[model samples]
Target chain A: MEITDIGGVLCNGIKEGKYGLGLVRVRGSIAGVFTQNKIRAAPVIVCEENIRDGVVEGVIVNSGNANAYTGEQGMRDAREMCRIAANLLGCEERRVAVASTGVIGRKLDMEWIRKKAPEVYSGLGNSVENAERFGRAIVTTDRFVKKAYSEKARIAAVAKGAGMIAPNMATMLCFAFTSAKFDSGELYDMLRRAADKTFNRLTVDGDTSTNDTVLLISTGKERVERDVFEEELCSVFYSIAKQMARDGEGATKVFEVRVDGARNDEDANLIARAVASSLLVKTAIFGCDPNWGRIIAAAGYSGADVDERITLSLSDGRDEVFLIDSGRPLGNEERARVLMEKAEELVIRLRLEKGNGKGFAIGCDLTYDYVKLNAEYTT
Target chain B: MEITDIGGVLCNGIKEGKYGLGLVRVRGSIAGVFTQNKIRAAPVIVCEENIRDGVVEGVIVNSGNANAYTGEQGMRDAREMCRIAANLLGCEERRVAVASTGVIGRKLDMEWIRKKAPEVYSGLGNSVENAERFGRAIVTTDRFVKKAYSEKARIAAVAKGAGMIAPNMATMLCFAFTSAKFDSGELYDMLRRAADKTFNRLTVDGDTSTNDTVLLISTGKERVERDVFEEELCSVFYSIAKQMARDGEGATKVFEVRVDGARNDEDANLIARAVASSLLVKTAIFGCDPNWGRIIAAAGYSGADVDERITLSLSDGRDEVFLIDSGRPLGNEERARVLMEKAEELVIRLRLEKGNGKGFAIGCDLTYDYVKLNAEYTT
Candidate 1:
């Protein structure tokens, strides 16, 4: 798989990393998934319409002003973006997908797009620098660029999201490219299944956004076994999802909640998501305090079929400390506290006695910087 | 309608208000509501069982340890608490209801209870000071006393909760008394209806506690009109609920999100609760920034049938500013910012174009103190 060309231009011409226009030129069949939010952005709507035919020539994404909730003007601006990108890339207008992320309910600066689209297209090239630029261009409050490559499967993926994240998608924007041969139907199914297990099980502040989009384009340049391809695809997605959580607004650390032995898969997912989305649990992690009661309470209120015969433990991948065994406190305060203070990556393991179902979710600690970044975002 | 007798004893023998035992000895028919969390506390289980016969001669409450997930020993401790209270108050053990709040999975210090329960009962008296002590005794992290009285209907209520609050109940604990004559069935119905509208529509940290309990007792001393009693009962509950929001852990301000013109009441409620529970929205309010996009995005992803033709406005009771009108940005930034900065109590009003359904939720701003308090709660 290969990214034939990619480039980014600062649409607002500030170069302060605030506003950008990204262009990725490739010939492939595309499959995409969008935010389930009822009030989708205009760009998301246009991309949904464009991707229906399972063919795409390029992608145009802009940051700094989300073309959302701007009424008819927003829709027109989104389509005009595609038109500009298609005209420069020598592709049909309906074949060019468009995406935008930033402050919601704002109109896009059409003049900047009209000027930068051609410049970005002209500078397109296949290089690591170009990939980094493209990753940087699609971020709003993100602290770092997110990119993942699977050498074995020849797949590359980029993602941008910091806040406004929750299960079932968020304000997250992700794009992947591969030269492996796969039909659009197969690509769509694979992407959906992979995302359901990765992106759909992530939370940051528990606020799903209005402009979340993920696209996978197969260039059909090589052939690989379905099992190998699916495994690599999932690995790429998992890496990007972890980066999204680690860079969550002002996140200092990222954690994963794994639930096992639930009554069913649904119950396991519910418990894991509830714990990951709980503010109390996030704050406790931020403070490096082993407050297991909040975890239990979150699980209890998660509408899952939970009972008293549950076990909870914490780990840093190497060392493990049991906080509760069979729903009884083990009072391992000192060891748990030390693990929390020292762990680079934390994992909370909860095992129920109901059945053999399992699920997991990734989340970030709620820090003061998160509040500061989001509170002062639009101001 | 009257306190009859109320008192509190320092259970842990520390006068700094860390722990206390509260006893309210007023014979009446009782109606109660408990947390819907699956892992109910031992005290919650005891209360549920004792209230089945609709008789409550007294209530024994403790702060600092929640007898939850303590296995069989916790159940025995809870029953023993009721027996101790009943023996001291000269009431049947089966007629005494018990409630507890604070850390989960900790066994109650039964020694303190056996020593302090009689002391608290002996000092029982019908006085405002006694009521204040009782209120203080039931609080864990609450910042101030929460109590409300209705002179017209002879009703009084007290509540204790600051964090771990959400819709469908929380870590909140409330007790109300009235001398008005009402049957247990009527009282139960009234309390449920009032709580459904008031306490059930509030959010602080969006974490429902396992020990939330509310009790309403009616003594046969006065006879008020049914309509007047119900109206006053709702008013009292609303007052207590508002206080709980205002005193939310580390909170400096409280706000209400009012959603109107939704497709149905359920949709309206979903939207209101989503907006209120949004951390981004709460932080924006805390920063005094009118980031209306977060509000709109929260509404969009609330699983409600919302559209772009919604109007959003902010008010401080005396003044109002519209941020969005009919899906168009009004750009009233300066006015909205000033209102957010100056308003003592803020109200966010959203009008949808679907139907005539309306709902409202009360919430507090997210602050650094909230994170600090919860992070260090168990440590």
Candidate 2:
């Protein structure tokens, strides 16, 4: 297994504003997932086509503009990006996936991109700095860098997204590389399963973006067992997903939610994601108010099979206590206050007593800073 | 036709710690609409039973507790409220519809409530002060008193809500009265039609509350044609609903939205409400972004049939210009700025060119004040 130094070029482009871009090359089969929003960005469309052949050699990410909603010209620009990357990497354009993230609706500056492609290619080398650069280049409004490495040091991932997107689908960007033996189909099935329980369950805001995407590459340089690789992938995705929730635009703490004892996984997820998406619950956590009624109310409206015979509890990653038991308030203000006052993480646990199914989702508390950060710009 | 002074009593209850409550008695056939949430509040449950007889002589509101999710005791407390109001108003308990709004799940302070019922009854009179009291008493976190009197001087209405509740349903409490000659059937039909285009279109924080109700009463003293009364009711509800949006918790302005040229009324409403309920669009309006892309994106995801052939415009209730023409940015910053800068109200005009059916919805911008007001407490 080898690392590449090309990530620095991608990082440099974003920092310099010459072009918001990044690139990483791997000799492997690749699989990907894209946003479900009907309105698709040009690069997302480009990536969709390039991944069809299953053999992917590299990934190129551009920032500064989303290259979305630009009509036909936008499509041409995205294709040109792949063409440029292919030329530099000495691979077919179809084997290279390209992604763009930034403000939506603006046209990409291809002239600047054309000039930087060769530089990013020359910068490629086997190193951790290259991976870090790749992570830095993909960021949009993210407050912190999110990347993870597997225990055996064969798998690595970088992700960037701070704004709230959606449940059931992603509205951010992610890329993972592994020196594990797998075909595109095998990798895609595993990636989708892992994502459904990871990034897909994380919501920042309710708005779904047009540029969400995730790519997984199997470099085949090392032979890790499938089960172990899956475990590592899930772990890495969890860490990055948690980071995204923690660094949610203007967020102060990560809000972790678990919905348990439901009739099925779907019901559990429905309630858990609904609780995560609720601005009232978010703000309650933000203000240090352990108001479990809001949580129950949100669950009631989640289209899940919820009744009065449910219990709700809150914790600060340590001490936990039920605020509502069997649909009645169990007042414990002192313990709740101490738990809610945590500055890093807040946890909500729900038990429905309806079934054994359970699900989890993460969100950030809504704060004045969140509104300020998101509302100040026109994007 | 006459105006009563009982409003002051209602308003006073809200102002003092005595109650966030109101009661208005009229000799009429009454019709009502309530929230569709499965987790019905105790007061909502009681109102549902009373509104059935089609002979609502009075409306008794008890504030300070929502009387929701409080189990059997909450049910008893709500019925008891009607029992007390029936005794004081010289009517059967079934003749009075009851409503409650405040923090959810706590038991009603019946001792305090029993002490205030008689004072409220004694304070009732035939003056505008009484009507003011009724309006004031219904408020929870409302920053303004909302009331409307029809131009014909035969109809008056009062409403209170500052958050989003339901789409096909309501999330606020409103009471309206008329001396027009109509049966409960006619008035209910009129009220439902008017509300569908007015209150149903208004959105705040997109969180559906468990307790939401609207009641209309007819005194049968004056004769107005059904069409005319419907028109009048629509106008009154529009005015009050606009005020609710304008004063939404900490909202700064009423964000008005109009969806036109749709395939059907449902499609138009779906698109319009989607635009109104979007946090991204709300935050943009609050930030004075004039970012039309967010509006288009929201419409696309509204579960309505939409394509590239649509036009979007912004206005400040007067001057207006296109932000997107047939899915392309119109690039008119100057006009958009003036329209978005209006302090009182801003408008979004959509032309889908799909058909003639149109729809309207009202919402408030995402602002720091909303977070501050809602986050400070656990309600």
* Best candidate (score: lDDT): 1
Weakest 10 consecutive residues, lDDT, candidate 2 chain B?
B5-14
Candidate 2, B240: how far from true, in Å?
A: 1.7
Q: What is the lDDT of every predicted structure here?
A: 0.81, 0.75
User: What are the per-residue Cα lDDT tens digits for candidate 2 across B71-181?
Assistant: 999999999999988898899999989999888778998987788788788776666676667777877677666788685737777777765422212247888877787
Each candidate: how many clashes? 3, 21
CA RMSD of each candidate after superposition? 3.0, 3.2
- Give residue A147's error in model 2 in angstroms: 0.8
What DockQ does candidate 2 have relative to the true complex? 0.46
* Alpha-carbon interface RMSD for all candidates, in angstroms: 2.8, 3.4
User: Can you write out model 1's per-residue Cα lDDT over A236-288, one digit (the tens) per residue?
Assistant: 99998999888877778789999999999899988998888888888889888
Give the local distance difference test score of model 1: 0.81
Q: Write the per-residue lDDT of candidate 2 for residues A16-96, one digit (tens) a residue.
A: 453457877666788898775567788999899999988887778887688878889999999999988888878898888
TM-score of each candidate structure, all chains considered together: 0.96, 0.93
Off by more than 4 A, model 1: A1-17, A164-170, A203-207, B1-17, B164-170, B203-207
